[model samples]
Target chain A: MEITPEKLRWIYTTMYRIRRFEEVLLEQTALGKSMGVAHTSDGEEAGPTGICAHLTDDDWIASTHRGHGHCIAKGVDTAGMMAEIFGKHTGLCKGKGGSMHIADFTKGMLGANGIVGAGIPLGVGAALSAKLKGDGSVGVSFFGDGATGEGTIHESMNLASVWKLPAIFVCENNHYAESTPVEYAVSVADIADRAASYSMPGVVVDGMDVFAVYDAAGEAIARARAGEGPTFLELKTYRYHGHFHADDPHTYRLPEEEELWKARDPLPNFERRVTEQDLMDDVEMERIRNEIDQEIQDAVKFAEESPLPPLEELYTDVYVNYSNPPQGLR
Target chain B: MTLDLRPDPLGPGFDVPGSEIRYREAFNRTLGDELRRDPDVFVMGEDVAGGAGREHLGIIDSWGGAFAATKGLIQEFGAERVRDTPISEAGFVGAAIGAALTGTRPVVDLMYFDFITVAWDQLLSNAAKNRYMFGGQGKIPITLFARSGVAAGYSAQHSQNFYSMVAHIPGLKCVAPSDAYTCRGLLAAAIRDDDPVIVCNHKKLINMSSFVPDESYTIELGKGRYLRRGSDVTLVGMSYTTEVCRLAAERLAEQGINAEVVDMLSLSPIDEDIVLESVTKTNRIVIVDEDTPRCNMASDIAALVADKAFDSLDAPVKRVTGPHTPVPYSKPLEDAFIPSPEDVVATTVALLGA
Candidate 1:
C-alpha cells in the first residue's frame, strides 16, 4: 500500500506527540508534579502509532501499563490524559484511573490495565461485541511480551479465531516482562507464531518501523473488518527505560542492551526516513515537533493548575445507581 | 403463587408456576428473553455458541457450554449477540465488565466456577467493586454464571465452591439457587440488578427439571425460604445442599423429629430473619454445605446464629459440611468428601438426641 502524505504526517505527529508527552511526564515526575508510578512509552512509539493508524475512533484498543503511546495513537485527549496522570478532576477517567488506568471510552480507548495480559480478553470481548453488533469495528489488544505468557492471551486468541470475532492481538514484544527478559518467561520463540496454533494469521513486524507496523496492522484490521476473525501481530521492539519510572537502579538489564535499544529509537528513525524520502520537509517536521512540544507543555500546565479530585469524589462513580450509599460513603 | 409479604424462612414469595426450569435452560431462556427485551443485553463466553466452526453442523450449540445451557442461542440471536469467546477468562470477563460499564449488560459464562481464578481480579476488583469504588458513578450490571460444586466426577480444580469468597466481598452479591424455580427467578433478578452478581449453578442441577412459569418472574436477593417447616429442628442449606437438607428432613421425620428446611438462596445479604425465626422456633439447628468446612457458608451462618439467636438454640449448631480436603476423583472418596443427606440426618439426629 502506498503511504499518503496526510497519513505520513499523522504518523509523525502522533509519534512526536507521544515522545514529547512522555519526556514532559518524566520531567514532571522528577519535579514531583505527578503522583503514581509512571511508565513511559518513549521507545515503543512505532508499535502503537503504526497499529493505531489503521483504527478509527470507534475501533477499541486496550493498552498496557506503558500506554501513553497507545493513548495518543488512539486519539485520546492529551490534556485530559495528562490531567489524569496528575490525578486532577479534568483527567480522562475523572482522576479515577491514574497512569496505569487511563481510559477514554468515548474514543474506544479502553483503560490502560495494570495487570499484564489482562487487556487481551477485554479486546477480544470488544471484538466480540463489534462482531455481534455488526459494527464493522475491530478491537485491538496491545500487551508486552510478558503478557504472552498469560493464559488469557492464548485463550482469547483461540476464542477470537473460533468465533471469527473482529479483533487484533498486538504483542508489543518489548524484550522484558518487567525485569525478566522475554526469553526467560515466554516458551515460544515467536509470540506471533502462537497465533497459528489458534488457526489465525500471525505476523511479526518491525516494532521500530512505524510504516511496517501500519502495513501489517492495516491488513489484519481489514481482515477483521471483513469478518475474518482475529490476527496476532508481534511487534518486535524494546523499551529504553526500566519497567516503570520508579524502576531505578536498573540492575536487571545490561547497560549495553539499553544503549542498543536507545540507538534504534523509533522517533529519530521515522524522522530520518521521512526526511530522506522527502515525504516531510525538515522545517515542517521541526514545526510539528515544536507544536507537539507546546501542546505537551500546555497539558503539563493544565494538569499542574487543575485541582485534585475532591475527597467526596472518592465516593462517586462506584455504582451507576446504587440505592444506598456505599459503606464508606455512608 | 402470590408474592408472600411474610418473608418466609426460604424467602418472601411462593414458587412461581414455571420457576422449575433446569438451571442451564433457565440461563439460556433468560439470555434470550433479556436480549429480546433489551437490545443492549448480550451473551459472551467460551463455546457459548457450541458449533462455531464445524464443517457440517449436525447438532446445535455442540458446546452449549459444557452442560448445554446456552445451546441454540446463536441460531436465535446470531453469532454477534451469542458470542463465543476464546479461553481468555480475564480478557472476556474484564471486557464484559467494561462493556457493562459502557451501556451494555453482558452475561459472561466462566464455564466452571473454579476457572474464575484466572479472572478473579476483574470479577472481584473491577466488576464487583467498580460500582462501589466509583462511588455510584458507574453500575456494572454484569451477571457471571458458573457451574460450581463437586459432581459428575469432576474433581479438585473444577469442583470447589467459591461463592463464599465472593460473598466475603462487600460490593458483590452471591446467589446459589437450590432448584430450577429459584434459578430462573434469581437469574432474572440478577440481570436487572445494578450490582455485579455471581450465580453459582450447581453442575448436578443442570438437568434437574422443575415447573417454570410461562411469564417472566424475579426472585429478590438476600432472601431465604422454608422448603419444609417443622417445630423440632431447623436445617439450613444452600445450592445443592438444599436438596440434601430436604432429604435429611424427610429422614428425620421418620424418627418423629419435625425438621424445618431452610434454603438460604442468597448468600451475601443473608436472610437473617428467616434463619433467626427458624432457630427461635425449633431451638435446634443444623447447617449443611457442599463447600469445604473452613470459611464457608456453613461457618458464616453458624456464626450468625450464634451471635443473634444464641438464647433460642436448644443445642450447639451442627455444621454438616464437605471435608476440608480437595474434592477427590474417586466416587467413594468424593461422596465421602461432600456432605450427604445421611450426614445431614445424622448431624440433626445427634443434635436433637433422637
Candidate 2:
C-alpha cells in the first residue's frame, strides 16, 4: 500500500489522539471527575486507526468495552465523549451512556457495548441493512479475543457469510478477558482461523504495526466493498492497562509480557517509520503532540464546566409515548 | 388514574363488521398490510418465509412459520421483504435490533414465547435499553411476535406464557390481544409504535374467529376494553385469559352474578386506570392470568389493587392463576396446570359472597 503524506499524518494523529484520550481520561477519573468504570484502549490503537482510516461516516462500526480508540478513529467528538464519561448534560449521550457505551450514530459509531459479544450481530445487522438499501456501506465489529468464545460471534459470522453481507469482524487479541488468559479460553490457536468454519477469508495481522494492519485491512475491506463477503482479521494486540480502570494488570500479566508488548507501542513505531522515511520531521511530530495535549486539557475543562442532566431525565426516552399512569415523579 | 378508555377501541367502524377471521389470519394480514404500508418494514425469523433462497428448487415459503401466522406472505412480498433466517435466535434477534437501531422497521417472529430466553439478553440489554441508554437519540421500532402458552403437549421447553418477565422491564412494551379483532389492531399498533414492542400471540386463540374490519387503524396502546359489562363484580384477564374471563362471565350470569369482563390488552403500559376503575366500581375483582401464580401478571395487578384501591374493595383481590410449576407434558397434568374458567368463576363467586 502506498503511503500518502496526508494518510500518514492522519494515522499518527488518530492513534496519538486515542493514546492521549485514554491517558487523560484516567487522570480525570482519578481526580473524581468521571462517573463509572472506563476500559482503556491504550495499546490497541493501530487496529481501529488503521482500519477506520479506510472508512467514512457512511460505514458503521460496533465497538466493545475497550472502545475509546474506535470512537476517536471513527471521528466521534472527543470533547463530547469526555463530558459523557463525566456524566454531564453536554455529554455525547446526554450524560447517560458514560464510558462503556459512548455512541454517535451520525458518525457510524454504533456504540461501545457493555456486554461481551452483544455488539457483533449489530454490525451484521448494519451490513444487512446496507445490502437491502444498496447503499454500498459496510459494518465492522471490534471485540476482544475473549469474545470469540461467545456464541454471538460465531452466529454473526455465519449469518454474514451466508447472506454474503459486507461486514468485518476484527478481534483484538489483547491476551486477557478480565483475569482469564486468551490461550486458556479460546479453542483455536488463531482466532482468525475460526472464520474458515464460516467460509470467510481469515487473516492474521500484527496489531502493533499500523502499516501492516492498514495493508491487510485494505484488502479485506476491498473484498467486502466488492460484495464478495465478510472477512475476519485477528490483530494480535495488547492493552497496557487492566480490563477496567480499577483493575491491576500486574495481578494477571507478567512484568516481561507487559514490557515486551509495550516495546512495540504503535505511536513510537509510527514516529520512527515516518521520520526515517523522511515523510515527516521531528518539529511536525512535536506540533501534533502539543496540539493533542492541549486538546485533552480543553476536553477536561469542558466536562468540568458542563452541568449534570436535569432530574426529570429519569422519565424520558423509555418509549415514544406511554400514557398510562403518565411519566414523571410522584 | 381512571378507566378513561377513549371511546371504544373497536371504534364506530364496528357499525359495519367487515368479515369473520381467525387470529392467525388477522396476524398474517396485518403483517402483509404493515409491510406494504411502509417500505422500510421487513420481517426475519426462523422459517418466517420458509425455504426461501430455494427458488431454484421451487420451494418458497414451504412452512410459512410454525403456526402458519405468516402463511402465504412470501408469495406476495417476495423473499427479500419477508426473509427467513438460520435457527440462531439470539443472533437474528440482535441483528433485528441492530437494523432497527440504524434505520428500518424490523418485525421478528420469535417462533415460541419459551424461546424468548435464548434472545432475552439482546432484548433486555440492547433492544429494550438502547433508546434510553443512548440518551434518547434513537428509536428501536422493532416488533417481535410469538405464540405464547402451553398447549397441545408442547411440554415445558416449547410452551410458556412469560410476558410477565418482559413486562418487568421498563423499556420493552408487551401486548396480549384476546380476540381476532384486537389481535389485528394491536399488532398494527405495535408495528407502528416507535419502540421495542412484543406482540404476545396466545396458542389457544390462534384458531378462534371474530369480526375484523378491513381498514387499517391502530388501537391506543396500553389501553384495555370491556367485553362484558355488569355491576356485581369485575373479572379481569389478558390474551386467552380474557376469553376465559368472557366464559366465566357467562357462567356467573347463569347464577345471576352480574360479572363485568375487562380484557387487559397491553400488559407493559397496562391500563392501570382500567384495572383500578373496574375494581372501584365493582368493589370486588378476580384477576385471571394463565402465567404462574408467583410474581406474575396476576400478582402485579393484585398488588396494584391492594395499594391503590384498598378502601374500595368489598373483599381481598382474588387471583385465579396457574400453579407455580413447569407446564407439564402429561395431558391431565397440563390441563390441571392451566388456570381454567371454572377457577375464575369460583374465585369471583367466592370473593363476591365474602
Candidate 3:
C-alpha cells in the first residue's frame, strides 16, 4: 500500500492519540469523573487505527465494549467523548450512554456496544444497506476473540458472504475475555480458521505492528469495496489493563505474558520502523506525541468544566417523537 | 351486521369508501403500499419471501411470510425489498436494527411472538436502546411483526401475548391491532414510526374482515379510540381480546346493560387519557387480556387505574385474563385456558355487583 506523507502522519498520530487518550481517560475514571465503567483500549491501539486508516466517514464500523481506541481512530470528537464519559451535557450521547455507548452516526461510527457480540450483525446490516444502495462504502466490525463464541457473529458472517456484502470482520484476539482464557472457551486454535466455514477468506495479522494491520486491512477493505465479498481478519493483540476499569488481570494471566506483549507495543514499534526506514525523523514523531499529550489534557479540562445533564434530560431522547411518555417514565 | 359507532369512524373525510377485507389482507396490502411509498423501506425475516433466490427452478415466494402478511408484496416490490432470511432470529433482528440505524426502514416478520425470546437481547439491548444510549445520534425505525394470542391448540409456545414485556421497556413502542381497520391503520403507523414498534397480529383475528379504507393513512401512535359508547361500565381490550369485549358489550345491551368498549391500538405509550376518562365516567372497568397472569398487560392496566382513578371508581377493577398456565394442546384444556366473552361478562357482573 502507498503511504503518502500526509497519510503517514495521520497513521502515526492516530495510534499515538489512541494510546494517550486511554492513558488519560483511565486516570479520569480512577478519579471518579466518569459515571460508569470505562473500558480503555491501550495496548490494542494498532487494531483500530490501522483498520480505520483505510476507512472514510461514509464507511461504518461497529465496536465492542473496549471501544475508546476505535472511537478516536474513527475521527469521533474527543471533547464530546470526554464530556460524555464525564457524564456532562455536552457529551457525545448527552451523558446518557457514557463510555460504553459512544457513537456518532454522522461520522459513521456505529456506537461502542454494551453487549458482548451484539455489534456484529449491526455492521453487516450497514454493509447490506451499502450493497442495496450500490454505494462503495464498506462496514467493519471490531470484536474480540471471545466474541467468536457468540451466535450472532457466525450468523452475520454467513449472511454477509451469501449476499456478497462489503463487510470486514476484524477480530482483535486480546488473549482474554474478561476473566476466561480463549483456550478454555473457543473450540478452534485460530479464530480465522472458522471463517472457512462461512466460505470467506480469513487473514491473521500482528496487531502490535501498525504496518501489518494497515496492510491486511487495506487489502481486505479494497476487496470489499470491489464487491468481492467480506473478509475475516484475526488481529493478534493484547490489553495493558484488565477487562474493565475495576478488573485485575493478576488473577487470570501471568506477568511474563504481559511483559512479552508490552515489549512489542505498537507506538514504539511504529517509531522504530519509521526511523529505520527514514520515513519520519524522531523529532517529528516526538512533536506529534507532545501535540497529542496537550490534546488529551485539553479534553480532560473540557470534561471537568462541562456541566452535568439536567434532570429533564433523563426522560428525553428515548424516542424521536414520543410526546406521550411511557406511563412509568412520565 | 353493519358496524355503527357514535363518533362514526366513517364520518366526514374519515374511513375511505372502499371494500371490506380480512385483517390479513389489510396487513399484506399495507406492506406492499408502504414499500411502494418509500424506496428505503424493505422487509426481512424467515419466509417473508420464502422461496426467494430460487428463480432458476421456476419457484418464487412460496411462503410470502408466516401469516402471509407479505403475500403479494414480493410480486409488487420484488425480492430485493422482500428479504427471506435464515431462522437465526437474533441475527436478522440485529441486522434489521442496524439497517434502520443507518437510514433504511426494515420491517421484520419474526413469525411467532413465542420466538421473541430467541432474539430478546437484540430487541431489548440494540433496537430499543440504540438511540437512547447513543444520546440521540440516530433512530431505530424498524417495524417487527409476530403472530400473537391463541388460535387453537398451537399449545404453550405458539400462543403467547408478550406485549407487556416489550411495553415494559421505556424505549420501545408496542401495538396490538384488533381488526381489519386497526390492522391496516396501526401497521402503517408502525412502518412510518421513528422508533422501534412491535406490531402484535393476533392469530385468531387475522382472518376476521372489517371495513378498511383503501387510501393510505396512519393511526396516531399511543392513542386509543372508543369502539362503542356507553355510560355504565368500561370494557378495555387489546388485540383479539377487544373482539371479546365488543361481543360481551352486545350481550350486555340485550339485558338493559350498557357496556363501552375501548380498543387500545398502542400499548407502550399507552392511551392513559382514554382509559382514565372511561373509568372516571363509568366508575367501573374490566380489563381483558389473553396472556398468562402476573406482570402481564391486564395487571398493568389494573395498576394504572388503581393508581390514577382511585377516587372515581365505585367498584373494584376486575381482570378477565388467561389463567396463570401455559396454553394446553388438548381441545378442552386450551378452551379453558383462553378468556372468552363469557369470562368478561362474568367478571364485569361481579365487579358491578349485579
Candidate 4:
C-alpha cells in the first residue's frame, strides 16, 4: 500500500483539476453562460481521483449528477464536457444532454444520471457483462450519500453479490442530499455496513485523503477482478459549494460545520502531505496549479466560441438510424 | 399479399396449421434457437430457471417463468446464459440495458407488462435513451418480453394493456403480436435489432396458436399485415383484437358488406402507407383496440387518417375501444370492458352507414 511518487503527482494533479473545473463552472453560471443547473465536486475530488487512478479504460464507471470530476478522472475530454455544459454542438452529447446527463461511452464512463441511485444497477449490469465476457475488467458506481436511501442500490448490491459479479460500489457521503441533511435521511450509521447483508466486503475511509481511498479502492477492485465478488466502500467527504449552482447551502448548513469541513479541504490536505514528505515541492505544486488553471481557461474559451447545436441535431442522436421512424420523432 | 380467409385453427387445446404450437411454445423455441445461434445472447428474469442457485429436487427448471415463456431454456443455455433473478425489476432491467451496452444481447422478461411500472425508469430513461443520449456511441439491443391484456381472471392489477405508454416514448420500439406466426418473427427481429424493443404478448392469446415456422426467421419491424382484404371498409386491429376483427369481418360478409382487416403489428412506427392505402381503397375505416381509449393507438391511428387520408375518407374514423377503467374481475363486467367481435361488427356497420 506504499504510495509512489507518480501516484502522488497524479492524485495531486487530478484533485486540483477537479477543483479548478468546478471553479470555472461556478464562474460560467454566475455569468449566465451555462445552460442548466450544475452540481460541482469542489471538495470531493479525492474520492474520484483515488478510485479512478486504479482503473483503466477497459473498466467502466457509472456516475451521478455531480459528475464532472468522475468524468475527468475516467479520461473523458474536458473540452467536450465544457462544450456540453455550454450547450454547444461540439458537446459530448451534441448539446442534447447538458451537465446532468453528460456521458462518453468510449472512455467507459456511463452517462451521469439525473436520477439518484439509478447508476448502481447500471454499474452492476456492466460488471455482469464483463463477467460473462470472462474479462478481468470491473465496473464501479460513484453515488452520493443521498443515493444510499434508494432501493436500486440495495437491489443492485444483492444481485451483484449473488451472481458474484465484479462490481464496486463507492458511496461519497458528503453529509447532504440536496438541502436535506444526511443525518435525518439515512437510517444507517455507516452506509458501508449494509454491504454485510449482501455478503460483501465493506470499508469506510477518509474521502479527503487520496492515499487512504487509493489503497482501499485498489484492494476492493483487485478482489472484484479475482472473482471474489462486489465490495462497498463509503468515503466520508463534503461538498464545498451548495447542492447546485443556484442553491443556497446556508439555508440548511450550519456555519460551524462548514468551517470545520473547510479546514480539512481535500485539495489542501493532499498538497500538505505531498509537500511535507518532499514527494513534491511548493514550486512543483504551483506549476501544476497554474497548468490546470490555464487548461480550464482554454476549455471555457473553446466552449464560448463553439456554435450552438443545429435544430436538426434534435433528431440526430436519438438512435443509430437517424432515419428509422420507430425511434425517431418523424 | 393475398388475405388468408381460412378460419383460425386455434381451438380445443390451441391447435394450428402444419404442427399446432401454442403461443408460449413458439416463444420458447425462439429463445432456444437464438441462444444456440449467438454466443453473446442470454435470457434472465424472475423464475426464468426457477432453480438458478439451488437444485430443484432433481428438477432443473420448475417455473419456466410466469407464463412458461422461458420454459426449458435453462437446460439448453445453462445457468449463466439463462439466469433466474430475485423480484427486483429495476435492478435486472437496468442490468440488461448495461449488458446490451457492453456486448451481450439480452432478452429480459419483465414477467408481467403491469410490473414494468416498477422498472419504468430503467426502460424509459436508460434503455431507451442510451443510444441517443450517448451521441450514437452506445446501443441497447435488449428485447423486453411482457404479457399484456387480460387473462381469464388475472383481474385489474395483472391485466392492463399499457403498450401505448411505452409507444409514446421516442427511442423505444413496441410490438404486440396477434398470433404465434407473428410472435416468433417479431421477437427474433427484436433480439437481433440494434435498438431496444418491447414485445407485448397478450396473456389471453398465450394458449392460441397459428402457423409459425419451426426455424428462426425475423419479420420486419414497423410493418403492418393485411389479415383480410376487401373494398367496402378497412377494419384496424392490434394484438388480440386482430382475431376479433377477423371474426367481425366474417359476420360482415354474411351481411353482404366487405371489410378489409388490417393488423397494426408494430404500434409505434406504424405502417402508415399500408393504412393510408387501405383507407383510400375502402373509403371507410374502423379502429379496434383493447387498450383504454384516450392516448392509445386508436387515437394515434385516427389522427394519422385525419391528417393524411382525409380526402380519401368517405366517412369519419370510428373506434371501438376498451373502457377507461381498469379490467374488472367480474366476468360480466370484464366482458363489457373489453371490446368484442360484436362491437367491431357494430362499429364497422356504423362507419358504413355514416
Candidate 5:
C-alpha cells in the first residue's frame, strides 16, 4: 500500500497527539492536579493510531483501561476527556466515569472498561446490531494480551463468527498483563492463532511499524464490512509506563527489558522510514509536533477551567425517573 | 383524581380479574400484539424459530423455544424480527441491551432463569445499572423472559427459583406473574418500561389458562393485587404461591376465618401501601413464598411489615416458605420441601390465634 501525503500526515499527527496527551497527564499527576489511577498508552500509540486511521467514525470501537490513545484516535474530544480525568462536569461521562470508564457514544467509542475483557462482548453486540440493521458499519474491540484469557472474549468470538457479524478483535500484545508477563500466563504461542478455532481469519503485525498496522487493519475492516464476519489481529507492542501511575516499578519488570523496548521506539522508527522515503521533511514533522503540543496544552487549560459536577448530581441519574425507585432508595 | 385507587378491571393496575389462558400462550399473544402494534419490538432467544438449518424436517418455527412460549412469533413476524440465537447467552443478552440502548426494544428468553447467572455481569453491571451508573444518560428498555420454579423432576440445578437474587440488585425490576392475564400485561409493561426488567415465569403456570382482554394492556410494576379479600388475615403470595393462597383461603373460610389473599406481583418496589393497608385491617399476616426461607421474599416482607407497621400488627408475622434445602428430585421430598396450602392455612390460623 502506497503512503499518501495526507494519510502519512494523519498517522503522524494522531500518534503525536496521543503521546503529548499522555505527557500532559503525567505532568498533571506530578503537580497533584489529578486523582485516581491512570495508565499511559505511551509505547502502544502506534497500534491504536494506525488501526483507527483505517476506520470511519461510524465504526464502533471498545477500549481497555489503558485507553486514552484509542479514545483520541477514535475522535473523542480531548477537552471532554481531560475534564473527565479532572472530575469536572464537562467530562465525557458527565464526571461519573473517570479515566477507566470514559465513553462517547456519539463518536462510536463504546467505553474503556475497568474490568479486564468486559468490552469484548459489547463490541460483538454492536456488530450484531449493525448486521441485523443491515448497515455496513464494523465494530472493533481493543484489549491487552491479558484479555485473551477471559471467557467473555472466547464466547464473543464464537458468537460473532457463528452469526457472521462485522467485527474486528484487536489484541495489543504489549508482552505484559499488568505485573505478569504474557509468556507466563497465556497457553497459546500467539493470540491470533486462537481465532482459527472460531473459523475467522487472524493476523499478527509489528505494532511499532504504523504502516504495517494500517495495512492489516484496512484489510480486516474491509472484510468485516463486506459481510465476511469477524477477524482477530494481534499487534505486537509494549508500554513504556508502569501498569498505573501508582504502581511500584521495582517489584516486577526488569529495568534492562524496559530499556530495550524504549530503544525501538515507534515514533523515531516511523520518522526515519517516512524521511528516508522522502514522504515528508523534518521541518513539516517538527511543525506537526508543535501543533499537537499546542492542542494538548489547550486541553489542559480547558480541564483546569471546567467546573466540577454539582453535589445534586449525586442523587440524579440513578434512574430514568424516581417514581418507582429501587427498594434500597426508599 | 386521588390516583384512581379503585382498580380498573381491564387496566394494568392491581385488583384486575385473572385470565384462564396458559402462561406460555399469554406470552406468545403479548409478543405478537406488541410486534404488530410497534414496528421496533422484536423477539430473540434460543430455538425461538424452532428450526433454522435443519433441511430434513422442513419445519419452520418448530421448537418455538424450549417451552414453546415463542412458538408462533417467527411465523407472524418473519426472520428479521423473530431471531433465534446460537445458545450464546451472554452474547445475545448483551446484544439485546445494546439494541435497546440504540433503538429497538427486544424481548430475550434465557430458556431457564438459572442460565441468567452466565449473563449476570451484563444484566447487573451493564443493563441494570446503566441508567444510574451513567448518571441517567441512557435507558435500557429491555425485557428478559425466563422460566423459574421447581418442575418436580428437573432436580436442583433446573428447579430452584432465583428471583431473590435479582430482587437483591438495585435498578432491576423483577416480576413473577401468577397467571395468564398478569403475564400478558406484565410482559407488555416490561417491554415498554425504560428500565431493565426480569420476568420470572413459573414452568408449572405455563399451561394454566385464564380470561384475557382482547385489547392490549400493561400491568404496572410495583403494584400488588388483592386476589381474594378477607377480614381474619392477609395471606400474601406471588407467582405459583398465588395458587397455594387461593386453596389456603378456601380452607380458612371453611373454619369461619376470612383470609384476604394479596398477590405481591411486583417484588422489588413492592406495593407497600396495599400490603400495609391489608395488614392494618386484618391485624394478622402470613407471607408465603416458594423460595427457601433465608433471605427470601418471606423474610423481606416480614422485615417490611416489622419496620413500617409493627404497632398495627396484632401478632408476630408468620412465614410459610420452602424448606432451607435445595429443591429435591423425589416427588414426596419435593412436595415436602415446597410450602403447601395446608401450611398456609395452618400458619395463618396460628398467627391469628396468637
Candidate 6:
C-alpha cells in the first residue's frame, strides 16, 4: 500500500496527539485536578495510530485499559475524553466511566475495558454484526501481550475463525502487564504464534515504526473485509510510564531496559523517518507538533472547566426504563 | 383447577392441544417464532446448534443445549442464525452483549445457572453496566437464558437458584416463570425489552405443561399475577416454589383454611403493590423460595413486608426456603434440600396458630 502525503501527515499528527494527551493527563493528575488513576500509552503510539488509520466510523475498535491512544486514533473527541477523566457531567460517559472506561460509540470506538482480554469477544460480536448486516465493516480488538494469556482471547479468536467473521486481533505487546513481565506470564515466545492454533495468520510488526504497522494492518484489515476471517497482528510495543499513575516500575523492571526502549521512541523515530524520506519537512512537523500540543491543552482546559455530575444522576442511567425502583435500592 | 385466562389455545389445530406442550417446547416455539418474526434475532450457545461441521459423522445438533430448550432451533433458523459456540461462556456472552449494543437482539444460553461464575464479569461488569457506564448511549437488548432449581439429582454444582445474585445488580432484570405459560410470555417479553433480562427456567418445571397460547404474547415484567385468591392468608411463591405453594394452598383448602397463592414471577422489580395489597387483606404472609435461606428473595420479600406492611400483619411473617446447604445429588437428599409443599403448608398453619 502506497502512503499518500495526507495519510502520512495524519499518521504523524495522531501519534503526536496521543503522546501530548497523556502528558497533559499526567500533569492534571499531578496538580490534583483529576482524582482517578490512568494508564498511559506513552511509548506505544504507532500501533493504534497506524491500525486505526485503515478504519472508518462504520468499522469498530475495542480497546484496553491503556486506551487513550486508540480512542484518539479512532477519532474519539479529545475534549469529551478529558472531561470523562475529570468525572464531569459533559464527559463521554456523562461522568460515569472515568479514564479507564472512555468511549465514543459515535466513532465506533468501544469503551476502554478494565478487565484484561475482555474486548476481544466484544470485537468478535461486532464482527458478527457486520457480517450479518453485510456492511463490509471489520472490527478490531486492541489488547496487550499480557492479555494473550487470558482464555477469552483464545476463545474469541477461535470463534472468529470458526465463524469466518470480519475481525482483526491487534496485540499491543507492551512487554509487561502491571509488574509482571510477559517473559514470565506468557507461555509462547511470540504472542502471534499462538494464533496458529486457531488457524489464522499471525504476523509480527515493528510497533515503533508507523509505516510497518500501517502496511501490516492494511493487509489484515483488507483480508477481514473480504470475509477471509481474522488475523492476529502482534505489535511489539512498550510503555514508558508505570502501569497506573501510582505504580513504580523501578521496583520490577530494570532502568537500563527502559532507557533502551526510550531510545526507539515512536514519535521521534517517525519524525526522522518521514523527514528523511521527504514525506514531510521539519517545518511542517514542528507545526503539527505545536498544533497537537495546543489541542491537548484545550482538552485539559475543557475538563477543568466542566462541572461534576449531580448526585441525582446516579439512578438515571442504570436501566433504560427503570420505573419501579426495586424496594431494596429505593 | 388451573387458571385458563385466555381462549382455549387449540380448537382448530390439527394434532394436539396447545396445553399439551412442555415448557421446553414453549421456549423452542418462542425462539422459532421470533426468528421468523424478526430478522435481527438469533440464538447462540454451547451445543445450541449441536453438531457443527460434523455432518458426515451424522452428529447434527446432538445435545440441543444442556436442557433441550434450543432443540431443533437450528433446523428452523439455519446455522447462521442458530449458532453453536465452544465451551466459552465469557467470550460468547460478551459477544452477545456487543451484538445487542450494535443491532442484533441475541438470546444467549448459559446452559446452567451454576456456570455463571465463569462468565460473571462479562454479564455483571459489561452487559449490566454497558448502557449506564456509557451514559445510556446504547441498548443491550440481550436475553441470558439459564436453568435453575433443585431436583433432578444434578448435584450441588449444577443445581442452585442463583438468579438472586444477578437480580441484586442495578441494571439487570430477572424473570422466573412458574409454568409453560409464564415461561413463554415472560421469555418473549425479556427478549423484546431494551435492557438485559435473565430468564431463569426451573429445570424441574421445564417438563411441566400449561394452557399456552399458540401465538406469542408478553407478560409485563414487574406485575405479579395471582394464581388463586382467598381471605385467610397470602402465600408468596417464586418460580418453581409457586407449584409447591399452590399444592399447599389446595391442602389448606381441604382443611377449611382459605389460602391465597401469588406467584412472584418477576423477582427484581417485584410487584410490591400486589404484595402489599394482599398483605393488607390477609394480614398474614408466607414467602417461599428455592434459594438458600439467607440473602435471597425470601428475605427481601420478608423485609419489604416488615418495613412497609408491619401495621397490617396479624402475626410475624414466615419464610419457607431450601436449607442453607448445597443441593445434594441423592434423590432423598435433594428432596429434603428443596422446600416441599408440606413445608409451606406447615409454615402457614404454624403462623396462623401463633
| Per-structure clash totals for the candidates | 38, 0, 0, 0, 11, 2
Which candidate achieves the best DockQ against the true structure? 3
The reply for model 5, stretches above 4 Å from the true place, is A2-4, A326-330, B1-20, B55-57
Error of 2 at B10 (Å): 7.1
Model 6: which docking level applies?
medium
Residue pairs with backbone overlap in model 2: none
Say which prediction, candidate 4 or candidate 6, comes out ahead on DockQ. Answer: 6
In angstroms, the error of model 3 at A239 is 0.4
Each candidate's chain B TM-score? 0.93, 0.97, 0.96, 0.94, 0.93, 0.94
Lowest lDDT 10-mer window, candidate 5 chain B?
A: B1-10
Lowest summed lDDT across 10 adjacent residues in model 2 chain A is found at A321-330
Candidate with the larger lDDT of 1 and 5: 5
> lDDT by residue for model 1 over A1-330, one digit each (tens)?
688899999999998898888888988998987878899888888999998888888888888889889999999889988998888888877787788887777787876877777767778767766865677888898998988877778777776776687889999998888888888898888888888899999999999988889899999999999987888899999877678887852688878877887888888898898888888888999999989988988999999899998887766665444333555222
Off-target runs (Cα >4 Å) in candidate 6 are: A326-328, B1-18, B56-59
Q: After superposition, how far is residue B79 of candidate 1 from its true place, in Å?
A: 5.1
* Candidate 5 structure, TM-score to reference: 0.94
lDDT of 2 by residue, B195-226 (tens): 89999998999999998877766777888888
C-alpha RMSD values across all candidates: 4.1, 2.0, 2.1, 3.2, 2.8, 3.0
Please give me the total number of clashing residue pairs in predicted model 2.
Answer: 0
Per-residue CA lDDT of candidate 2, range A150-200, in tens?
899989998999999999999999989898999899878888899899999
How would you class the docking of model 4?
Answer: medium
Cα deviation in Å at residue A220, candidate 6? 1.1
Scored on chain A only, each candidate's TM-score is 0.97, 0.98, 0.98, 0.97, 0.96, 0.98
In the range B211-252, model 6's lDDT, one tens digit per residue, is 776666777788787788888999998889999989999999
What tens-digit string does per-residue lDDT give for candidate 6 at A101-173? 8888899988899888887788889999998889999989999988888888988998899999999999999
So what's the TM-score on candidate 1? 0.85
**TM-score result, candidate 4:** 0.96
Q: What DockQ do the predictions score, one after another?
A: 0.27, 0.78, 0.81, 0.61, 0.53, 0.69
